[model samples]
Target: MCLNKITLYLLLFCSCINESYSANISEDGSFQLNGYGMVAGDFQSEYNRPKNMTLHADPTGPNQDPRGKMGDLGNSFWHDYYTSLAVTKKWTGIGAPEQWADYTYQVVGYGDKALETAQNYGRFGGLNFLPDESNIWAGRRYLDERINVFAYNTKEVHIDSGIGYSSKNFDFAVGTAQIDWSSSGAPMAAEGSRRIFDLTYRLGLTEWGITYVKELDNPLGTGVQQATSFSAKYTMPNYLGLIKGQSSLQIQYGKGVIAQYLNTSRISVLSEKGDSSVRFTVDGSISQFEDFTVNPAFIYEYTKRDKSADRTTVIPDLAYSGGDMIYGYENETGIFGGVTVKQNLHHQNISMLYEFIVNNTRNKNGVAGANGNAYKISVGPALQLDVLPYIAPLASLTLTYAGGDREVTLLPKASEWRVGYRMEVWF
Candidate 1:
């Protein structure tokens, strides 16, 4: 029960359940309610190896797991919780519109195990004729918007019930999805249904988008699976001199099926190539100092898959799968950079943040020094209070440090250090 008294009794039981659910919301007519909730606690430390340090060449293969190394060390603890709720209604009888109409209903629930596997229902309910140009109804939502940090970003779609169309620049949506590969142990695949489409275009600070997916009936017999994604973004405000720029680009193409784990015979192979990636990023921001603010960014990525002479097989060592070396089926190219700084004290309700990142990987079938690099840093301080008047409370604490090598751990080294805490309350 120690661990700082279980993190101070889970932060006083999540601030007494957000002050008893903040008096069950609902105020001022025309039906409207709001919500937000968050809680986080984390601790991490890494590096731990010994026990024959092996990737098994049959030194008892069945017991091998632990070679995603990169500065290895270990220790961990976690806690997470999320909540959201929204309800809105505005309209007076017949013909609805005359001025601002509304329709909304939302719900969300989350957990990190413990609330007995907590899981809540409905999230994203809709209906609006001129609700910002157009609207429809849906259940889950966050329809595609490509952004990546570590692969898997073909415009992350998530829409259960869908329909959309917007104006004042353009936006569109169409959906259907329910794909679960059972935690992706991927014995081929299971749990299926997919169909989604997205499109976007915005002028003025520039924007562009596209998304498509169709993966019907995939019990992993293959059969059907197609993906496409493209994205673009641009911004420039007071360019150069006062700095304020932004850039983004993304691309993806696919034909799915990936699951490589032949760790010297723990076996699990299912390759059916055709995967691609190209990512780009550029960032900027500078606020002529005063209360401080500076942001910077850079990123580049290139991923690939679709190489095989029957996907090789002939092992007894020389292992390293998925990022390959399994007889040669590799891919990876990255270049990352980051910087973030924010400062605002007192008058701004306290705030401070710092971040840094650096990564350089290369292993497209390696051989020239096989490149590798990694770096990360974080710092934090935050406090926003407004105790009552619909309550508002927030807290933060962060510290992080990361490590690298073997192009970020293809085993042979690793590192980690993390400390986190977060609390929030809102109405």
Candidate 2:
């Protein structure tokens, strides 16, 4: 790993000159290095939907995200693989008695069938310091660390360049990004900027957060195109109040720009007026037994958007109304419920895993025969290195059934089979 010692040292000096700084990231000064990513290959017998789902007629589903479908949601080989490598250095007991400073840089990337097609394109780096009782940070960072579910990371957070301050239990941050997005993810000029601000407070076992988004310049001529997001979450460290596990419940809502909860980076783009979304999630993991464990999650989401129809003007005969017509708002409602059951089949090192998901997303305005619902089940045996910290290799065979409305698959029901190999880890 390449180290930017100069940058880290310069920022470490920041709090020492101030004298009032007091915080310790760790017991002593240390150099910390960590990274996480996934490598996976998936194959399907026939062509099918994209890696994520596009709920019909809905502005968005799963927290107002057209990309509601994720994890193993028909993700092809090309779409299922990515990696992130990060490095961090913390300086403690170096200056001002007890001062903390952190420098981190992470690079995310994607690959193709050939090695040469791979590109490490995303860059997230930042400088963080605790000056006095407040924590100050800047640079492109993962804003909201709280996630609805660990499997798919469904939540709202800005992954852009910004600065933030946190003191006591109150936190505030503002970030800006380009309206247009590219794979490279390089920031653009602020001519037409997508700006975001977030404020959050943690009280006891619950967290309350709100986010506001605005477009500084809109090429579509939509004035004050904006969106807002709010969420209330409660977290419990133990399962059933006694077992060894963790669980959380979250309720979320978004309007205008429509919250892209599934999006890990980049601000959500402009949306048609009157777009709104709502979501509820419960996620938990139980490791009550040494040889058996389970992770379960349930999600319900709804989104609404208004469609427009231009009035017929050139031909007077078809004109029902002299002014433009509003086609009324369309709504989408869906539930994503699933569970992953893990059982150790070997000498407690080899595990058999079963993951099942039921999806039912609908469009109120779609044709009578149209709906987006699927049932998927994936089972695999995993081999984890006992000496290592994570599950290294897990290959699975997946069966997916798409059946809801006849219009969805042009038939009463459709089924597809897939084989996949994946190794995911974060340490």
Candidate 3:
């Protein structure tokens, strides 16, 4: 809610500029048009071994390869298209004209998808009742408070067709969405909808928020499904020539219907019950460590389930490669530590990350077994370049490698390597 002196100056300077593009103007010439379009795509390759499967007789099932059927395979170019339009006007009674009221509409598409596809359309709109003090809007959008500035926010909660209100010190939203066990595959209508709520406040140097999700009729009959997040962030000014620093702590707890997904193709068809999970994460960033920007993060997670809970429920987001491994839905706990560093080289940015993960499966009595203890290391490197100044021509490449020791009936030991490249042009 606070703007530094330089930002204030920039705002003041921009107010004096006149728009060169205007269409469908109102009688008072207050209406204007603006929009941007972008096309992007990426290609990737992965190599790994098949797990718990034999070319001869397979007990786990058919077509089950622990290392992957294609030990090495190339992914096709996945595409994305995005565009947005906005209209704004000044309300004399509401103070500043530019901040008075505005509306926005956006649409995005995937590879080979039709433009009119309802599933591809993303829309939002808002009416400012009191300039920046209060507003209301609805649509599918990300509305979570992101505390980590240096990394992609994997923790931001997403919602659909949600209404929200923002004031000087507080922000909140509520919405409903279909319950899906994973982000992939077609969702089933057999289950009831889930309701989402989020509220946050800013006070002095820290911001805090709580997010809750509830299931109306959880298929698992595990009572009302609930996941709650309590989080806080503290920001400090820069010192010793480094940019300002930020630290964040977040805790998440979930009970009842818990769904777990791994990779993109497979779905653990077994519906799990008596699922409960807890997770704590600490993330911090130092904008500059000498010539490199360093961001460090740590996570501790634990999940407990009934004897019948599938082992997959205990797995965390393991795409990063080096973090601890949680193989299945047993009672397990995991700890992860990682650091990401970015440095500017010539006109490009080079970034690298390294992570260490350790996890163990424990019984109801909290006794760990060697059969379940696992460890892993993950590494990733990436580079981005702006080859052309016009239309924001850009290209990037990333590589990730992960390997570790895991005790599983299937593929007790497995590793993965992936390389990907992306290209984009915008206007």
Candidate 4:
């Protein structure tokens, strides 16, 4: 039965594509196609040494012996390709407006199909429903608007769709998604499904601007969850010559029942089982200085089980631009970087950056100190190239050394080095 359904869907998709192409050829002179391709490879290694400690050491450890040394290595590679084609027409005879229509299709294939270990390699096409003020009827009324929707369907289709009125700042959207482990050749206890309703309101309060969003989610075989967020920004009046640019402050806070599937199994043991928890997040940014900006944020998360435990974090980031040596630094209490620097390049559009990161965390037992505490120092050189017509290339190389207490049975002191390179092309 599943095979029959799949065959029917594929046949329908091909028929629609052929019909659309034929109609475009009859209405327009020609069509254009464009796309890009990329391939990447990644390699990782881990070295761990345990110490003689408790009897039932780490279950995740390679061996039952807590005082043992182990090493692991893994590598993966993947490729992605995408293409888009569009047909356009010009109005000449009757009283008609110029119009254009496009249909894009993309597919990605991979060698390893494992959900956690497999590499992603496809470009999902977006839906664009407006070119020259076209109209479509949803239920009964004629809806004349612009619509854009994008989704990723590797495991389950995660969709984000919305319709805009163009003249007014009001929009509404509904989305549904399902995750099937069978697609990835994996066993599943039960299939997961999610449905969401989103409403956005944008209002112009005199000179200030305000935006509000309400999101509600309903999961299959589960209860409903909802969240509300609001943000407002106002530009202060420039009375004197103290401030040059606009200074604005924004705040957002949301509290709701977090979806059980959204939690990671590695983070919480109860994540695999059906468990409920309340979560809240409050964060904001402030632009007070003309050339300098400061952003401080905090988060407190708690989960309930047989016992309740909570974790809190604070981060402060400072950045300064329009200077000889641009400085940017961020510190996440004790766990992340405390300082960083960017030295200007000589004669070229290149720069070098140096950063220091410290991570510290404490467990509920208050023993073994913090599980994921470490210190990392990173230095990298970045180059920005504007080679030809409307094309720019950015390349960077970074090297980091992470050292600190490791999670071993008894002696947990290990250090490692990592080197990475990144390149991007934009047009």
Candidate 5:
């Protein structure tokens, strides 16, 4: 709201009209206020039936196959509460520590209300000062704010804030911004704005970047109103030399209003006249390993729309009653791959988890759910407090596989199981 009233009148004129510039701010120069929260609950059963499901999952099962993920596509299941908040400032020795400032806020909701879903780093925050080795942030900054949508910020559109800069005289450069909205208070023009140009370099284990996203203003009869995107992120680290972690690759391409949120573009124009999308991802990690640690991920996505986009039966003198279920999708494709293993079990707090997944989906027009191939198997045990596992309480046992898709029909096509307990944490 007007940038929170101009940051509360510049913090009330810098603590009441600056008291000698407040000792140039430094008391060992470090401050942080961080937060993350999780509270989840779910119970379901259908196999020898009796558990009387509640709060979700296993409707026709395979976790209802792809509903734009968050445990769904992977079938891990979470029921509610995911949040993050942050506050920070830096300046040490009363001099330069690459001055910094931070403010971040996030919202997530599911059952029983936690702000009823106003997802992701909304009203994000930032402030940086360092005219040397990089740091000059002014408004809108994004790089997957407040994380978690199963990571990789679900691949781009930057998010949105506005007015930004990076390359405090270059150090390989880094500048970001994000804003996306369709609802959840003020922000119009269909609510999406992206303007970015990137340059990053680091080689020793590989690190590369190429980014360009330009989306802004749109909404007059829709046929297109600014849209373009390009992305490339590459990283490689120790794997074979000893497997100390890190592996990455991401590729993206979009057009016309960033092509339908790619999943949640949040809107701001372009629904037809050539919509498009392309995506690819590869995840990483393999941390040392003695007790165990390994991670892997892969994703691929493709989307296309413009087969005369937008429809609700296109009003034929209007007079329908569920008559047109909107069977239109133009095209969509997906593939997922996964592997996760962790085992420390003790002194490090506790952990024992294993997972395996495989997925495939396709649609050219399917009534809002299910397509094909799905398999996920998770085994779990976790207990860690505060630092690392964040909170605690977690139990897992999931097995899913429903490869029967004649356009989905009660996929009791075999394997399905879930042993649950919620309460996730990450800090």
Candidate 6:
């Protein structure tokens, strides 16, 4: 049979199996199944483009220019679909025996045009050792978070075994996972393996609470990676004479080794092999204002590689939301700042955003700084419909204007304009 016929048959078989199994659960045990499916389509347009900017243009370019006509629009389109199903069963033992399990499956399809576009299919399952205790014992979990077909990739799975305890004041969990990383993304050595250990702790205080998580990853063929993150918050009590509301301050820091097995030519190297980086973040918010609120955050990151290079970044953001209007702006290191404002109406919601970035560097080998300086501005509006309580449709129309100056001999300046729309539904 044809490929399309095979896909149709497989979908039908899955639906029938779900229906048959859902009806077979014992009445004494509670069973529930839930699922959702979504489809999305997108289109883009641009202008004043350089030859190198075209998707299908020749790779060799010293003076490539953008195609600028109706047929030369150089636009490509694709659609995607995603679906997830979850099942849970709970049972109470009359005497002393008890057990429970939860299972979920997710599937993603990238394009309606080609089979090679199929992205991923995932399955997860969790089992509990005891089902009838105030602090029940939970044990086993298996997850396949990343899966890809059309390649030699098999399947990436993680098996986790852990213990968890919960209390009114605090909760804690410790788990160890074995990861089969070979089949994770674009395919690598089949013997690749990773071992992970994680711990989470929570403490409650009179005025606030604190939470922390520490995780470690050791790969059999690679290096060891570690990450630690924490957050704390404080709230004001009404009993205090002048303090009436709540305010929170949170901070987090993390540093670790980054790993990748993909070919460098085919991947964007965010960090070099055996590289280490430190990240610091701070966030604060206050609810003292009656109808309006303000939030501000800052982040700093520094990275160093064993042999290649090093870099640093800083970002700051501020926002205010209340009434019918919401506004925010963000400034990123070496990049542009962005500002946005939104207005809400009884029947519709509208918003606009603008961004401007400048890139300048003395280094001649760097990818971004190779260009003298680049700036871009984008503005758009969005609409949301609340026709039903559980169902709402969203649509966004955006206009993007971008330009940059390259010191290269061929193409010195480039610019473009693009438009796009999107819609979504949820329950």
Best by TM-score: 2
Local distance difference test scores for all models: 0.45, 0.49, 0.39, 0.27, 0.40, 0.29
Model 4, 1-427: lDDT tens per residue? 0000010011112112333223334425343222212222222322222211111121211121111011000011121111112222323323333332233332322222211111111111111544333321111111111000001000111222322222145444344323322211112111333343333345662121222222232222333323332223332343122443223333322223112112111111112122233322222233444422332222222322222322112111111110111111111111122334445555266767555544343331123233555455667776776343113455556676655655312223477665645443322
Return the TM-score for candidate 6, rounded to 2 decimals: 0.46
Residues 1-427 of candidate 1: C-alpha lDDT, one tens digit per residue = 0000011111112112343443333454556555666666555321222211111111112112222111111111233355655555554444443334445555554443322111112322134434554544444444322122221122444555576665668877776655443222222323356677777788887777766666666554546555555667766674344444434333333333221111011112223336555566665566767777766656565556566524433222212122212323456566666666768774556687676666676752222345677675667786786343225777767776766674444434576566766676666
Ranking by TM-score: 2, 3, 6, 4, 5, 1
- Return whichever of 3 and 4 wins on lDDT: 3
Which is the winner by lDDT between candidate 1 and candidate 5? 1
Q: Report the lDDT tens digits of candidate 3 across residue range 1-427.
A: 1100000001111112235443435876555543334343224211232221110111112112111111011111233233433443434335534344444333333333423211111222233435544655556544433223112232344454577766767877787654443211212212335687878788986777766666666544544445555556555554323456666666655544222211011112222346656666666777655656666666565656566643332222232121222233456555545555555454455444343333333431122452444333334444444443223434445453434443321232465454534444333
Query: Which scores higher on TM-score, 3 or 6?
Result: 3
The digit string of per-residue lDDT tens for model 6 on 1-427 reads 0111001101211222344334334575456443333443225311222322211111111111111101111112223233334344444442333433333232323233323211112211222442223242345432111110110001111224555443344434444443322212212211222333322234553212222212243333334333332333332343122444333333322223211111000011122234443333323333454533323233333333444333221111111010111111111122112222233334445433232223332211223333344444444555665453123444556555545554321123376565544444432
Q: How many angstroms is residue 170 displaced in model 4 relative to the true structure, after the best TM-score fit?
A: 3.9
lDDT of 6: 0.29
RMSD over all Cα atoms, model 1: 21.8
What is the clash tally of candidate 2? 0
Candidate 5, residues 303-330: lDDT per residue as tens digits? 6766666632211111111111123444
Give stretches of model 6 more than 4 Å off: 1-42, 45-85, 89-191, 204-252, 258-274, 282-298, 308-342, 348-381, 387-391, 402-414
Error in Å for residue 124 of model 3: 12
TM-scores for all predictions:
0.27, 0.71, 0.56, 0.44, 0.29, 0.46
Query: Which ranges of candidate 5 are over 4 A from the true structure?
Result: 1-67, 70-89, 92-155, 159-273, 276-329, 332-425
- Candidate 1's error at 42, in angstroms? 21
